[model samples]
Target chain A: MEMSAHNCRLVFVVLAVSGCAPPDSTSEEQLRPVVPGGFDSVPVPVHNPLTRNKVLLGQQLFFDPILSLDSTVSCATCHRPDAFFADGKAVSRGVGGRPGTRNTPSLLNIAYHQLFFWDGGSITLEHQVFGPLQNPAEMALDLASVLQRLESIPTYREAFEELFDEAPSLRGLTQALGAYQRTLLSGGARYDRYKAGDQTALSPAETRGYKLFKGKAGCLHCHHGFLLTSLRFENNGIAISKEDSGRARVTGLKEDYGKFKVPSLRNVAQTAPYMHNGGMATLSEVIDHYDQGGREVRGKSPLIQPLGLKEEEQADLEAFLHALTDTTVLAGIEGP
Target chain B: MNYRNNIFIAVNLMVLFLVGCDAATSDTGSTTLTLNLNAQVNGKPLSTDPGTTFDVNGTLISFESVRMYISEITLINSNGDPVSILGDGLTVPAKNEDDEDISHTVQDHIVLVKQDAGIDSYDLGTWPAGKYEKIHFKIGIAGTNNRIDPSQVPAGHPLAKQTDYNNHWNWNAGYLYLRIDGKVDTDGDAVPDDEWAVHLGTERFLRQVMVTHDLILEADQPGILDLSIDYGEFLRNVDLSDPDQRICHTMNNLPVANAVANQISSAFSISTDRKRTGGSTSADG
Candidate 1:
């Protein structure tokens, strides 16, 4: 069969055990399977092409704290590669050590997401970049000020001109950061190998646990796609807080209260302190919360029903979830 | 004598040809219309500069800023035919790379009335010279335009991210149609202390305001349609002294947002002022 470059890359990812080369040493062409799977159709916005130079510039900008007002926190501070792109914190701290309202979500496989943030407030990946940079509790830097700062730096200014054929601008900043994040693809979990025709890839308990997750646990209702997210806003019965009304803040509908975007389950094991508010600390606790059908709240989804699983079954389910982790992403980690 | 007479006759014929029948009669030519917004507080001239205090329900309130979105403006003629004011064809950035050709008219024909920025007069463009019965305009942004992607738009455009003093809400995916930021004196001290921001928006809060006038436009003449908005009338029922009634961002404080939205139309009055003859209408506050 004639295969497109993207389809060929997907096949290559599945066939090769070590699908993606490490981030630091990999060349531009070798960056194809940054995420391994059959997700050939990555939703990269056409306006911002995923060029190698742009991605490199974006990578530097992502780690640079100059975007913040205090120059102390970077995008990498909250979304750490060591922790599967999610900070292992209940709520992320920003400039001046101000606590954010929502948990820092993982950036792994973010290209697959249609909407951004817990409330699905931002429609485009480019649209989402302005929030944290200007949010007073976060970076605390205005767009005009940030542009001036970036413009003063010869390196950023030269790079922006070469890549975008323009001066350092709002478009250049958003597009660059977005391009770099689209490359943070995660795949090649043991579960992926099992799905790729290796029957013995999963242990007997993991296999049984996967069945329960799809069947009795009813996780497949929202977490079913290859990226393991329906990519839709849903009310999973998280306790409603008036200070943060979740999706209702965006849609302005009372019926949308307590709703949040169902995040992808890829690299779930590493991205600890789960849920929108980081209310749950562990995967087992998360599973337990779901097992009990979550907190009783207004506008809670009916899909969340009590799963009557035993202790052993719950343990197996947690083990199965661990199988979803991309071990290569955690290859060189030494400490907690 | 005959040659001089022939030259005079030729000159007269040339003037008739160059001027055209329409221009000669002064009945079919067009004129540019300018809309001037005059802001006031209880019949006095209003100033949005900080420390410019005004009386609102016996409380001294100083406005930090006052801005609103005006869109879908139409002028009703003597025959009651509506004339749409075509804007200068301004645009924001494209949402997609391929959509470069698409005119981002979501903000076109719309004016951001920012009194603090000293931008109050808007050129409504040239129109056929005649009389109009009334003027019509909406006080807030309409659907689709409110939800425009501000990221795509360049700075300085009316609907750009930074234009309305950061009026767009990053968390709500919509712009604040009308934003009023001020400080109120709660304890009877003349100096203002408590800061208040009344951000009115969301599709449900849109209000349409119409002003009746007997305006006449002369051929090739610039006309000014003077409009006045009273801060006293706008804060009619809302007691700014009450701590709970001071602030609103639409959804968070629905009561204050509703009160402001309900009082929008009554705040505005128009002056059918003829710039050529310098005449004023009775409603001119």
Candidate 2:
């Protein structure tokens, strides 16, 4: 069924029940989360209400290249589901075959992000949806064109009717994408299961990697949340020159030079060719880069101290990061 | 419709129930005030250049294209407190324009209809539902302007109507927030191209400025207390005289905007006109 009809139906059901209250508000099961401790049931922005139809529409939009200036790219062109919501490309290329300057970061657990982009300039998921669309070198279409294009599609118009009676718009696009993004979560990794008391899940190499990840390797200080990222800006030291001052460009602060968002590492094993500018081509190289005290840059974060690890520790950390991948979720979804 | 799928019906029912519970009432004698923001330059009312330059700064520097929102208004009382007017919000210099300012030309810049017609100060919850002392306001924009979701920015709003010249930052970036573009002696002579544009407002600086000045209205007194902004005083306060302080100079000094922003921000006082206020233009008063 179309989304608006579905929502109208759900709204009717909820409203009828809303007046009488639920069967049992204080039930232990009611208090328990539907998806474990995940899902802040309130969900996305209230203004951008989440609905199934819009989310489905957004999924179609994410895969549809009609959003680009030329019909060559869509959001999924970079955020493919099989590759942990990241394209395997060293640096994502946009229309007219132009290569982007920075690497396409992974989208796992992206819904929880407070800011988008390497520097965290885009503040909300809804607002961030248009970043690539407006970029001159990216999708290359201004928002007006994007809106006008969406409004022209019959499928999009039908989707809009199902999702909202009002036709296609940036808000619908953003909210749809955001709702789908919120669903792209990873809470059942081997480590997560291990932490949840199923210790029998990891092999010896994976176990060793878990220890190194927390201890001598010094990886957890920044990559610390349950999602495995402190989610702050740091000059991860990939920037060779001051010309592309990542976070500093947005904030104009001298200290924030080259600092990019510390992306969540939920599906780290699948998102290769890391860092903001995609300078390193492998995870082994990323560990080595960090081991060298982040290439000795002047604005480098002091926390990136050298970790003189033996080969076994590096391998263990890699195995541990790989342990974070939940192949079940990875294989089920096609694209965000 | 399936009874299970109709959320709007239930919500409508609740709204109806609430209205039935009580017929809400409010009493505030209202007065509508129209504001004509004559974009001026050097203490004179503004005039346009034929698509080359605008009122103050011409092609020497023009916001060829733009989109932005402004909101959050405040009115200062006779003493020193502020009353707020919410949602007097809008996105200015609308997206499309037919290449003309309606006021100056008989041919019509249809975009003129899209001009930011300011706030309707007579709305409820603004001033008490009665006569006031005086009305005072600022001319810039509020800080919380651009926080609006792009969808909420009113694409079809009357303000969004008009055909504009290609990429004219004029409407989107906000009222020449800092029009520093004239000439620089960086090497020697005053070269107009040597200008830098400092268009502030991070989707947060509301296109509209905060205003706090006393309004003079009473059941017993005058018609209304309307405070006037002296553009002359604003320009004089900035170092337009010094080569370095000139915001309109080729080098484009933005510190002047920051400085001017700092000066008139919270320090605005009510005025009867350019020549008078409550009692004093006296240096001490």
Which number leads on lDDT? Answer: 1
* Model 1 steric clash pairs: none
Candidate 1 is scored at a TM of 0.85
Give the top-scoring candidate (TM-score). Answer: 1
DockQ of each: 0.30, 0.08
Model 1, which residues run further than 4 Å from truth?
A: A1-35, A162-166, A330-336, B1-31, B85-107, B125-130, B217-220, B271-285
Worst 10 residues of 2 chain A by lDDT: A8-17
Per residue, candidate 2 scores C-alpha lDDT tens digits across B131-198 of: 23333333333222222233333344322312231111211222322222332223332333344232
Please report, as a residue range, the 10-residue window in candidate 1 chain B with the lowest summed lDDT: B94-103
Which interface RMSD values do the candidates have, in the order shown?
Answer: 4.9, 11.2
User: For residues A1-336, could you state the per-residue lDDT of candidate 1 as single tens digits?
Assistant: 111112111111221123444332223332332446566556555455566667767777887788899988778788876677788998988999999998999998887776689997876677788898888878888888888999999988998888767788777788788877787777779999999989998998899889988999999999987989987889998887779888888877888888998998888888889899998989999999899998898888999989999998998899889889887765533331
